[model samples]
Target chain A: MSVLDKIYEKAKANPQKVAFPEAENEKMMQAAYETGKEGYIKPILVGDSTRIKELIAERGYEESVFEIIDIAEESYKNDVVARYVALPHTMLKEKAIGRRMENPLYYAMAMQAVGDADVTFAGIDNTTGDVLLAGQMIIGLKEGISTVSSIGLCDIPGFEGSEGQLLAVGDSAVCTNPTPEQLADIAISACDTVKGLLDWEPRCAMVCYSTLGSGQGELIDKVKEALAIANEKRPDLDIDGEFQLDAAIVPAVAAKKVNRESKVAGKANVLIWPDLNVGNTAVKLIQQFGHADAYGPMLQGFNSIVCDCSRGAPVSEIKGNVVISAVRAMGQK
Target chain B: MERKELEAQIIKMVAQCYNADEAKLSVDSVFGEDISGTSVMMVGLVSEIENELDAMIQLSDAAACKTIGDLVDKVEEEL
Candidate 1:
């Protein structure tokens, strides 16, 4: 079965409560309807009630299936939201100040903060900054967390030699060019996420254009430093880098080229790029040109649960994203 | 700073980072051409601009920075 199938089964068994904040959007409302029908999650649709009803009728789905929180009317939304925040005065005041907190994205986050929902996903109509800030400010980054990054969970279907590979390419959506320390944190966080969400033992490769001392540059040095730090802290992990992409993934290629007897060599399922550009571009390339399936650009390192999807994503993509985000919310890794 | 001065600074930074001639930079300088900061360099430039200007410039902002003048206007607006 596919990864989504497994997750959907797991989620269905537990039937965790999840939220779709931008439920007012036509596509999101449609997705919520499907999610409800599937019985994997109890979805809270946060937006204007009338708009949601219109969308439900528009999609030809039953409106009684999902719960809706109407934020169109200030007094009503404020009354409901105010009860949740400890600083009710401040939240109430803010509700009165702005145009219903811009959209349900913020209000939805506030809901998650107060345990109204187990996981929240948005960004179809929001920017990364908007999603990140709402998450950081309202949800807040976790203690000991510095920045948020993304991981792509690619489920390649039965490539003759390799059956299942769950790889992570990161610092893609968040940090620009992380400091060496930040890179170490990213590696550790990604390793944990991979182990938790995908159940794959991490064979981490810190990738670059160069392979194992073949190249000389500052970028190479950064990758080397990060690998060293990550290994020192989590010595049990098979993490090594300053290697090229090909050597990292293919065991025979890595054995011949990298000259390292390390287990991670040629067996890397988690690839941590030197920077955001490499990580972001590499994943997109894999998805676009290589025909490899991709999931996420899911945010990591937040205190409470907050995740973002692409503004251009379809409902299935968002559904896949929710699986990853919900796994994160469960505090697995 | 006058908009032109900021423009000049942007041109200088792009020229240095992208290894292109300063003369190629203009208000409409698209990054990938006439000098380009690979993704790494773009992030670095964003940091530099933020540090120099004490503003919080985002990567999304960098996506629109095509030319020397384009970066200058962005920097000026943020400043």
Candidate 2:
């Protein structure tokens, strides 16, 4: 079966009330139909209803399967803007009023805030910055969460019908140049996310251009400091840093190259990038050039749910993202 | 070096990294030009300038530096 089928099966069996904030697109309609048909989610659609109906008819999608929320008629977008304006605090209402962009992410976030939906995913039709700003402004960041991160589930097929193992790579999407504190939070948060998915404990490797303290600078120091902080906070977490790809993943190479005697040195499942450029570029390289299948740029460390998908994502990709987002909102991932 | 000289040096460094026509690569020359540098190459250019010039610049600053002229101007200010 395909990945979507697997996710669908999982969702069908799950008792959680999953919700998807749909757009005026075919992919969302497809997922809504499939999820609703399977009783996997009480799908929520938010967009231009006429466009959605046209697309649904064009795709032969069943309209009876999902609940559609049209913003133009009900002025749902205006309602959210109004609510933000009515807030007693002057600073917040002013800040909300200043956001001139009529992005749908704000509406989606408002849905989550009011318990109208359990989770929301959008970034296919909007820029990453727009989606993030809406979430930050409306839902706010989680407590003790100073920054946001995007982790990808890298699932590559192994040789001879072996079960494919997943690798979590992160801070590659949102943060351009994270501070030491932010890096530490990224590592810890990524580890927590990974622990929810896999049976294995997280062995985080703070990937760098240079391996194992060979490079000395603010960037390297940042990783080192974050590593120390991560180790200190989660003493049981197996996390190491300032290591290159080979040193982090290859047993013999790590043993020969680095002297750090830790569980994360050779077999790190979660790899944190030094910066967004490196992290984003490296993940794309692994996905496209290395022929690895990537699942997310799953936005974490937010109080409300918002996941970003590639602009060229397929139905399966959207479904998988929805599942992950739902699980994250439910505090499972 | 004078501010103009520093800007010129920054442009020269960027041109060398980018392998573009030095004259065409003025402070105002746009990055990602068809005959100019790609975002990837521009990143290298930024790194090279940083290391050689011993100056600190955020990637955001480098990204927002639209033209070679704009880049040199930034280099001058940062330096």
The whole-model lDDT of each prediction reads 0.70, 0.68
Point to the candidate with the largest TM-score.
1
Chain B vs. true chain B: TM-score for each candidate? 0.80, 0.78
For residue B68, give model 2's deviation from the true position in Å. 28
Top lDDT: which candidate number? Answer: 1
**C-alpha positional error of residue A66 in candidate 2 after TM-score superposition, expressed in Å:** 0.9
Per-residue CA lDDT of candidate 1, range A188-270, in tens? 77877777666677788888878889898999899889888888877878888777988888877887887757777777878
CAPRI quality band, candidate 1: incorrect
Name model 2 segments beyond 4 Å from true: A1-8, A15-22, A48-59, A70-103, A158-164, A209-215, A233-236, A258-260, A331-333, B1-79
Worst 10 residues of 1 chain A by lDDT: A88-97
Q: Estimated TM-score per prediction?
A: 0.71, 0.67
